[model samples]
Target: MADLLDRRQRLAAALCLAAIDLPANAVAAGRQLMQAASVCPGVTMDEIPTNSRREALTKARDILNELISEASAP
Candidate 1:
């Protein structure tokens, strides 16, 4: 339970970092998230924001959306 929560946090942090255009230790963070997720198979990527700070989560979402939008632009 606690481990699963930790992984969710790690994923949120990693995505937040990526969204902000910052270089992140994503491989390690992803490993933690994956391990935690494996233990709790029902987990979804959406859980990341649900388990983090509201302000941070909002920023992460906005940044991620922008990043995706930018990437998809031709």
Candidate 2:
């Protein structure tokens, strides 16, 4: 269960990166978002402010990194 949750978090990070317009990957991101929306009926996307996206990405990255480092600790 923990592994599955971790994978989801990783996916979130990837989605956020793609949403942030990481060059050359916009198409991939668009496809992913569409797939997600399909699975999650009625789940829609909103055009949030740039700063909000940056903040979310930063917080998610920090949490993911901390969890990974803890799992790797001796």
- The TM-scores, one per candidate, come to 0.34, 0.37
Give residue 34's error in model 2 in angstroms.
Answer: 11
Residue pairs clashing, model 2: none
- Tens digit per residue, CA lDDT, model 2, 36-57: 5444334435422234446547
Task: State the lDDT of candidate 1 residue by residue for 1-74, as single tens digits.
Answer: 35534444444455444232223366765665666455545656654442444544585566566656876999
How many clashing pairs does model 1 include?
Answer: 0
Off by over 4 Å in 1: 1-24, 50-74
Candidate 1, residue 7: Cα displacement in angstroms equals: 15
Considering every candidate listed, which one attains the maximal TM-score? 2
RMSD (Cα, Å) for all candidates, in order, is 12.6, 6.1
Model 1 pairs whose backbones collide: none
Model 2 compared with the native: what TM-score?
Answer: 0.37
